[model samples]
Target: MVEPSVPRLWRAVLPICLICFLYLCSFLLFFCATNSLIYSTVCLLRANESYCAEIDQNKSLIILEESIQKESSQWALYGTLSFAIIACFISPIYGSLSDTKNRKFPIILTICNAILTGLIITIASIYQGTQLCLILYIVANIVNGFGGGTLILISSCFGYATDSCTHKEQHVQMIAIIEASLNIGVIIGYALCTFVFELHTRIWHILLVHVLLLVLALVISLVFLKNRSLSQPSTNNLSQKIIQPIYDIHDLFVGLKQNHLLISFLILLFSLFFYDLFRMGSGSIVYLYLHYMSFDDAHYAAYFSFEQLATCLALILLVLLRRRWKVNDLYLAIMGLCLSLAAPILFAFAQRNKAMIFGAIPSSMFSIYFAVCLRAIIARLVPEKDKGKAFSFVALIQNLDVVMGTIACVEIYQASIDFFPGLVFIFAATTRIIALIFILIQGLCVSRTPELLSIMPTDEIEEPILENQSDDDNNNDDELIHA
Candidate 1:
């Protein structure tokens, strides 16, 4: 059979566009679920008696800060801590399965799980008892984290991107584009939350909207997203196929042990994990912390949207800077680290809303750059076949960081909430300094091995075949199918 040739760029364009749209929907689902869960949790904790007054006769009356009090920080801490605990283990498995099977299904599964989680939180928000709501909150976290939450969902999306792109330079650009999509989604979600909170006053309604968006995202995935067959389809029974990903954990260790570049990449990921740990830990509590600063939901949502916009702008700036300067990823990373290092310090000592808002600006602007560079680097470091495992390990690190940082920050905050509400920020800032040092070392390694930057194989082009040559055309068609 004679095969018609298609343009290389055209082959990638459709999948890339679909992935970007999926990212938008998935992140919208993410931000909405997170904002609703945290805001409702905190508000409920602060105003528990209002909902449970008939049942709780022993509870004392307290309405400081208009039902947004210091004690409400505990809900933020517990919810985040519980989420990280389950997600840390699940993310690696999800990543491995993406490698062993396909990326699209795992991503679909995550969105479905997120929808369920949003519904549970909504039910919890409308319930009457504090203990019952907390139990439901814990249940919601378990479901959300069971499929690995946002990190695994994003890693699968990224793994799908790597499957489509073959060149190193293109990988970097695509990763940056994905990071930008995440920022854009955050901004949109935050704005929507702001609008809903201002207009409606009922937090459960916001969560219902979140559930609807997840359904939309799932539909989009089912209709538009294409799954590439990277690995051979398994011949095992359905039960074994389902259980096999858990055992695929060995692949991560094998990839790291067998490949030197993968080891170096893992070291770099360690640095990012520290940064993410502090960043996620502090982020979980920042809204409640802001409440103490006299900021309302509208103010917090608006400022947060502004910060996400700043992150998107920073990526744009980085692209421009790359065009003009002889800068490396590590160099750009250092610049971002310096900005991130300053943010938590400013937050820690900020006595006024202006300082807290200003503190968010620096970290928000450059943090995405660090992530972009890290993902780009890892995408280059691992072989094409192991990209899913590599990204999964990275996701695992993110989950562990979230768990560790949450535990540490929650403990520190609980102990110091009376005397020092800002102590957790100081600890978070210290972790950033540690991450900076690791980045410096990674920068030195990349400088020493410049070849690491261009590690991805370029896409191969097929030579033209005359119509008389049927055998050559069939071989080329088979190669194209495999590619």
Candidate 2:
């Protein structure tokens, strides 16, 4: 293969591809930054009154004690968990709708919701009273959660990528790229957040920036995104709309059963649940732990940015390794889990801020490993038409983990704050170990039967549709394009 001819059409599409790629990267970067920094910012602000009061008990200031700070953090986290609970019911519906309708509509709507969230949250941060801020926070969460928030937005994007890809390898590549873009975005967002906070102590200025970014993302989505006409038309009446997601769940179950990969997928789902549990649970409280260790806002932002940088590097390294070695995804996932397992241990035992920072190195790799491998595996296991539903289900599992894990970790942290604030990290470490076990089981199952490793091989995946697909399925597919 000295040279391969390029298609003229590909050249024509190249500019469009670049724009889409840029849009994805920008959207993910902003989203990741927000995710990395938002909870910590809220917790820190809420704790500030306590922190200041503790420092100067008689300064005529409004400050609670360390216990109050911890309590405030817990309640803010609870607000987040509540939003996640609400989002759980919406994710599947939006997912199915994305599969049935133009993904752009949901994508745009989600970005708009994010914009609103950023604006409201900025205003909330400005409020001196915690009660008012909390109320605003709840309102923001309600708006954003009802719009399906980040989970549905990401799933829809993935579903779009799934529809566009022609082969298993391409799907894997797309997922990796998406994950890498997100990691890079995390790095950008983390640093930008820190810079903004440092430059403007008020903090709401950073929120304004986030709002601007969300608006840009929304505009890009509206202007450049195109809907795919891959699915068949559906003939279900308006009455069926309410139960569509439930039926989609059934279809997903049926799809899993037909593939004989139900056990494997379930294992993946459980692993994801625990992995997210560890990730999100630790994420919610670690800032408070760092605060307890005397780290300031800059230090906190730097720590998160470092981890994201590590994740970005890990993804880049994986891409390079794939070219030079026959690296297995299972081994990569294990490596990630091992890092995840160790980071939490280090964090839990850390006595100083520097020690806690060291843990970010491993935790960074942990961030990139599980999602990339899991999504790649899922992309291969489900039918093209059901990709939206399958990913939606994954999102649901993740949201459940986020809500439950956050609640559990916050409670643990609050209960043990006086005696052992690090207990939450220990709990996180335990969950990672459990997640690793589940992943190992999945790896072992695939290793024993490599032929069953991928549902369709790179060469044999054919086109988007299969010959055995039903007429109803075909109609559903077509209708989604028009819906």
TM-score of each: 0.82, 0.83
- Give the per-residue lDDT digits (tens) of candidate 2, residues 1-483: 212112322332332334334443444334433443444444455556455424323323323445544655666576677678888998888777777875556667777777777787778777634567667766777777777776677777777755655446555556666676666666676677677657645556666666776667776676667765446656788879768989998988887887778888898899889888856555647766776666665677778778877777787776654434535666777787786666776777776658655655866575576788778788788877778888889988988877888888888888887777778888987887888899888878886765455642433422221223244445667899999
Q: How displaced is residue 381 in candidate 2, in Å?
A: 0.2
| lDDT per model vs. reference | 0.68, 0.66
What lDDT, from 0 to 1, does candidate 2 have?
0.66
Candidate 1 on 314-363: residue-level lDDT in tens?
98787665544535666777788887776777777775556666667967
**What is residue 397's positional error in candidate 1, in angstroms?**
0.6
